[model samples]
Target: MEHDESLRFEVLGPLRATLGQSELDLGFPQQRALLALLLVRAGRPVPAGEIVAALWPEGAPASAMNIVRRYVGSLRRLLEPGLPPRAPGRRLSRGADGYRLETAEDEVDLLRFRGLTRRAKREAATGRPEPALRHFVEALDQWRGPVAAGIPSPARDHAVFAEIERELVRTTVMAADAALLCGTPEHVLPHLGRAARLDPLNESLHARNVLALAACGRQAEALAAYESVRRLLVRELGVAPGAELTAAHTRVLRQEVRSAPRKRDLARPAQLPPEPKQFTGRQAELDSLRTAADSSAVLLTGMPGIGKTTLAVRWAHEAAERYPDGQLHMNLRGFDPLNAPLTAEAALRFLLPVLGVPGHRLPSGPDALAGLYRTLLSGRRMLLLLDDAFDTEQVRALLPASPGCLTLITSRRGLSGLVAAGARPLPLDLPSTADALAVLARHIGRERPAADPAAAQEIVAHCGRLPLALAVVAARAASHPGLPLAAVAAELRRSQGSLDALGDVRTAFAASYRHLPDDAARLLRLLSVGCGPDLTADAAAALADLSVRAARRLLDELADAHLVDESAPGRYTAHALLRVFAAELDRRP
Candidate 1:
């Protein structure tokens, strides 16, 4: 076999001709189109009639053969410039039957992609799922953008490329499924989510999502997936879910009950770390949360680690008295970095057993699960703590219909939807100076106070009276028992070196800011640059040079994001640390 690897052609994005490392610039559009047609046939000779049909689908021109010869001559001269002086024919030779463009298989990305996909399928059929997943991922990586992204071809060829794109999507879902079956939902969830979005009507993609969600322990969300699929099928196709999907949904809802209790629940309970010693201030905030819990849903929105979860858990423990049935807790993994978000179906599965429902009896869809959950808690009073929720959709599906059931949702983003849905929102602020000092004194003994009251006050003010910051500062002081309070205050004054003062509190602020959308982030940066303790919507609008209405909407979005505190209606202010962070971000390129 004569091997010619130097010749390469790319037809995916755009038609290109190259010889070895140097690209051959085929100047004429007709010449480039002719070369693409030749490459598609690979080593096989294509009859002149087929070539004419491909170029002119409506009908061939009178001078079609002459035009083809002219384009072929132009392509050969452009692409085969380095070829040794030939004796009889060009590198792109015209046979009596038609024409042939020969190149090695390795030179084409499309052929390589197809080869890898085929190998993956073979590996999967042999039960080597792990290897199949790796191959499929490799094949996908070969695609830089959509298939034939920039290429303009005949309608027939375009149809062929579209079919290839669809196949690629299917292959991706299969790979994701293998990843899920291999016990790696975190790795597969992003792929599945992307696939789901790409082909929203694909039932297989939705089914794969359920498997991935269940593997991630988000069983409620898994069940919710089934409901979404069912609804889509009914709405779009006027059909119910297939038997396989219904069976899978049933299994997920019952998995928890069928499984035995985990060791932690049965064995001696593992002692939790002692509660943070200096949880001061927020008495009013706590009372408001309790009151909201008594009525509709209570959403506690604040900067991350701002003790939102801490306060929620504490209140749940305190209010455990009212909830005779029991208190239920779930960390929804709302802000997880590597996994798909927890869905309502998965959350329902976690909750059903707690409500004493048997595995087989639990509903298969979010609506059904939610209805059953409400029915179980209809008469009995219960407290639910849903921590780290991402969005309203996630929380809304899991909400209990019964007024007797009280829910406390802690999220970095303010649950505006919850508020609009008649759930009360209790926003948390940084602790007061006195509260911060008390927290510090509680954590690090009061001996230092008599020595330097001024220093203690200074430390509280410098820490911005944020409880998380004060706790960290207090912990640092407690760890160094002999350190003078004045020295600690001096360290805090040097903000750059005061890592010990902020600790995880800084992380909380960062988390909340990270969740803001691009527009909201821009608005925040402008707000941080402008003067005043707080700005009205009009002032904020002027700073960004946006319309008053536009700026008002942005400000509301920021407020809903919890990055900007709504001190008064239509007025907003950033927390001290958040202001500093936003200023730093704005100054950067």
Candidate 2:
């Protein structure tokens, strides 16, 4: 947080003292702007006219140099309160050409980050992925926020620093990819996930996720990762999955080779799928998915009915075109109690033929089938969408070794093991306020009684912005045209009487709850007995008759289920519908 140290400044966040770590309170706007300009031109001299132009883009005072000198003098005095008496010619000198902000290379974090990234890139180019990843991670760790957070300058050089920040992200991703290639997907997943989240729109990260996932034996999960990326690209940018991603997906589904025979040859082209009928919010979640997709594979993970399947389906449809060979979609009923989760062998038995492998020739053992699957995809491009994966074992049997393929996997579990194998983790939650309202408007029509702007807002808010709840409320409103939004909101507020009226309304929350561990399920039901805005770890623990640590762990588990939202760092809250669902579950059995 310290901004004052040496002459060099770090502008990634709020302009802070990077040199001495001594905070210099530059009171005036002009003074802050002036320091920003110099920081951009660190280790170099900036001409006086350039400084004037930077400060005053349109015009400058005739005595700009004098004014500039005065500001510089003030900065020097402020920065160096008690300097040693100048030797012969050392009195903050100015010459005919321009003024210089004298500083060492070590004075700036930006400079340090850039230096490290550059080294990492060089190492990667030389095939030293391990060292490269290390340097890249070290450089990225220096960033606290956006580049030049509170400072803005009209100078072109300032823009260069902005680009550098972006490049830093690119470099960080490259380093993480290198680490994955160097044989440690698990080690790099956290770093890759963090970087991808920061830059969700980047396609390269999504591809990286696919690679990582396959490498870690989560092929089905890898396919799900691809679907998530495709959805984000379509929803956020209205763009289809790029050729690279489609080809990668194809490679995975077809079990393509790790490296293509012709290194420079692009994957075969594919056709894009139709766009979704209604797309609302989920900007942040989409970004997170995109980030995960940047890896070789990702697990689109969350509790049931939190739209994991919707997101996966949407992404698959959008990304279909990328895999010209074909888009292979499958669901492994890992969580269905009536039918046991499909084994790797059985799932492959169904998928291999869709991928063009003959049933008569398919391998018998899970490992053999997976090997054949990879062999089939070695040289081609394909996309695979694996939904409702049960565990790492089932998913691992389906992964292809080809780096050219993309895979997207969805699961209720956290699946950190998939992450260890380089699968990006795209965690899902409830819809945002805007998205929830849109869902209601879609289901009930914009002119419904509950569709009044204020009422609609209250309905969505009361529904906790959960998609299922929004859909149900909208359905109810549509069925009863004259029902007031206030009435629906009030009905939702009453837990005991709401369930029967809800009927199948509780289905989504029930599905999510069904997946929870016994202890977590018990705790969720217990916590539902309380009524409040949010629950801190302590409160939740007390409700569940657990110690704080145990309670916190349980709350986090609930969060993974998408039944509880982590409202703050250690605070949790259930959606209105989820609360009702839990209360009903508590009364059951």
Candidate 3:
């Protein structure tokens, strides 16, 4: 409601700005184009020359500067109604070489859309489906039509249009994924359907649509959707539908349904796996989890190999005795390389049997299974550990609608979605130097590290104090006790330029990197070339040749993925080994 009074700028559908209950007239076509350009580069200065080029791509007259100045004055007056004729413009300040539109983050719809999407992504990663679902829906709803519509310029050209459209399709697909996880795939069908019509060649959307259709029990419609995509791909690109779509079609053809078991058949399940032998550090995080023992859900998240699962299991093992009934554990495998994440239906199928319900008597659909799972857990005191979750939707379906139970989740993502659903988040960080040394000692022996303190410290620091990396180094040291601690440290330094020699570190880091979109991945590779131990957002922008705002957004994304650290705002640093890995990736042709 507060946003209603603030100035609202729209670019997804049209070029329009409004204040409160009235629409502000933004002037003629060229004038609107000028406004659109400024809005696109909001919070940053746009040089007069750049503006002139964008306004008239064919050519610009000698009076372009004068025309741009006049347009700026008019926009300033419209944006800040109280400003005097000659008074320095408050909203649109004139810089030495350009003008900048100073506006709040939420004033522009595009900015709001990005903010919402980032939050939704964090939530999904954190395993809070309800809020992730809400945020994704809100973010996707911002796209009314083509970006910068009705503007005549490069802004409306296919090149610019493609970028915005790609982002829109990506968001739509992600929202649909969340919906499916929340047992409401039907809600995203219409949006996905419209997107599929616009992007006929996007096999990913088509595959998801088929899955959604099948999930909703419309097997015929699902097959038809597949056929439609197959025909379109063949006609437009002279190729068949890809494997993902083909698999969806195959699944629909073999669809089978089941029903939930009677309450009498419900069984108490204790299925927690073994905790890591060398679990170290995380005293603070473990304490936080202990404090939230009464909370219905607690989500533990961090970057890949930060030991999210280790901490979750450690805490679960510590708390196992409190829940007398039993414990339930499942690895959702959200980031599995060979297999896609387990769906809510599949998860329930695995879980129901553990809870005493036989496979034959389990519910036929995800929604039904979720309902039955909740019904069975209503009054039971139990522990549910949902590990390696892909997003909030998958976690949501698996949550018991019970106050007496506690659900613990581990993920490589932040999972901001869980916060709205009353999940307490415990983001795990790399271990302290002391903890890393202790872990090494646990693996080998404290005698070697204790004999030479400085060399031992250097070894852990080179590993970035990450438990997994430290474990690898420790294992190597254990295999050759004759080798000095400094030798291992020297090996890490010598191999800093290459990641392959680091052992499965490549596989661990690549799993997280492979999930990023093309641009994000490219930016990371670029950062690897330009980066030192640490760099500010401005440095990143200069290295990548992107606008400051754009670089900052990308940096924030990298930080969220745990590829970089933003311990100090605006400054980013990557782990020593991660930087090497990124650099190695960029070197590939």
Candidate 4:
């Protein structure tokens, strides 16, 4: 037989096996289940009756034996293709009582993961935590995603996988603890952050996280992390924090914990990125933000590339002195095309240290981290700019628990869901002609637009009066001082069919478009192909061949996502750049 003896099997995230350079196909749900059941008990024969029970626990059919035999034959063919027909299977061989999968321990990813975890634990117990920490990292890195992500049932609930997953979590916490003991807790904060989410109710992990945070000199956040555990325990389990957690909280309160040295500690973080040099107009939106200043949170939602971040950053700088503690800024990267939206836990991991938690002392779980964040900000007046939010759930976990901090969140969608959380939504629209002209004047010389006033007005109109589009036009004009405003306007008008002159406009719109639900995405494409300047529900229905009721619901979704504007009741129209991007999608083969 030509089968590779070094065949590898995996059950970490999915059921997969590969030999040499080729991936072996594990066919059919039942056949795959049978293979998983046997592999978990490799080197020991699993009875035919046991196999049937594991694969179909409810009951077994009369032809269950025949089915198992047939599946075994199929799996054997794939596992050892060069074997002659009817030849005794070498990899999967029938025994006197049942069958056994002849595989070595090192050939399986699960075995390797478990082995590293055991070694890490042994090293930690021997007071050699640094080595333990390295093994712990290697063990945790084996997990590709959730356990048996898309595999059929029973295999997921199998005893081996469940035990290993539990072990992985414990190992992760152990590694963090080892790092803490070695005075290098800062190195394992990311791992602890992930494990804490996986096992939120684990009090030992929470205590360890708090200690690490305190060790980083973020005493305020450490105290808050303990309080988070106390509240969660009471709210969910109807109990108080255990002895260790209480001790950690008390130590943080008294400032007696030994914290790691700070390389560059700041009195307060002023992390806000620079705003546009010459921001123009949005007087009305700025006014609304001033009104919402007293509110705990304010959401500024609008279409793609519509100056949401610019407006928020500008206002943050303008009101910098109002927040005496400091300013915090994070681009949630929610609408980023290349990267996944930042999760609440990951965001807290980054923000907590800046707020004063020592790198080693940051909370491990999102809830705990958020609690620590809130505790640190409880009495301090701070400004938090959470830019490019994806949805309410993403925003909810990141909101400060205290009202002393004011959060400014921006999203490409309307985020109506945030209204329930006391967030006042201020939806932004295309800039007015006057405001658009001012933006152009700010970029190009004011005298240039004033010289050819008619052409400048036509340019803003053609760009749909969007600040982003207007800025694109202004940039092209600014690069060539000798170029006339009329010529720049002509280029914008001529390039309407393509995004060559739009400058990141299509890329921005595509980022939001990809996040839409399937029905909304399809409707967006159809609207580009068939809809008009202003479409009523009835007209939209005819264009997409959907019922009026269905079309209205889709339009409402589109409106929520800021993909289209509801000019009046049941009337929708997309921005010029958005329409161009959508039309481009429709033309795709």
Model 3: per-residue lDDT, tens digit, 1-589? Answer: 3545568898877889998878999997888888887877789998887888878888889998899888888888898888899787778888796888887778888788888999988866655555676898888778787688888856456354567778889988888777665556777887788789778889889887887887677878888888888888889889987787787677667663222343456676778889778777779888899998989999887877778888888999999999977999999988776678899889988887887766754535676577557656756789999998888898988887667789999877766787788998878778877888898898989899998888899888777887778878888899999999988888887877886555667777888888887877888888678557788878988888888898888888777777788878778888777887888988899
For candidate 2, write residues 237-344 as lDDT tens digits.
Answer: 999989767876876787642321121332333322345565556778766665555455768987556677777767767655665566666778877655678998
TM-score of 2: 0.50
Clashing pairs in 4: 212-360, 212-361, 213-361, 213-362, 216-358, 218-356, 218-357, 218-358
Better of 1 and 2 by TM-score: 1
Q: How good is model 4 by TM-score? A: 0.57
Error of 1 at 551 (Å): 2.3
Q: Considering lDDT, which of the candidate structures 1 and 3 is the better prediction for this target?
A: 3
Model 1: per-residue Cα lDDT at residue 101: 76
- The TM-scores of all predictions, comma-separated, are 0.52, 0.50, 0.56, 0.57
Across residues 561-582, which tens digit of lDDT does each residue of candidate 1 receive? Answer: 6777789887888777677767
Error of 1 at 217 (Å): 28
In order, the Cα lDDT scores of the candidates are: 0.70, 0.68, 0.80, 0.79
Off by over 4 Å in 3: 1-264
- Mind giving the per-residue lDDT tens digits that candidate 4 earns over 1-589? 6855568888666778887768888888888888877766777899988887777777778998999999998888888878888777889899887998888778876777888988987865544455677888788777665565555676556666566667767877787766664446677676666767767888888877887787777778778877877888999999999887787787677665553223234358999998779798999988888888889899998898789999999888988888888899888999998999999888888887786677766545565566455545555688999999998888887776555789999998777778886898888877878998899899997999899999899888878888888878888889999999899888877887778788578778889888888988988987677556878889888877899999899999999889999998778888877888888888889
- Candidate number of the best TM-score: 4
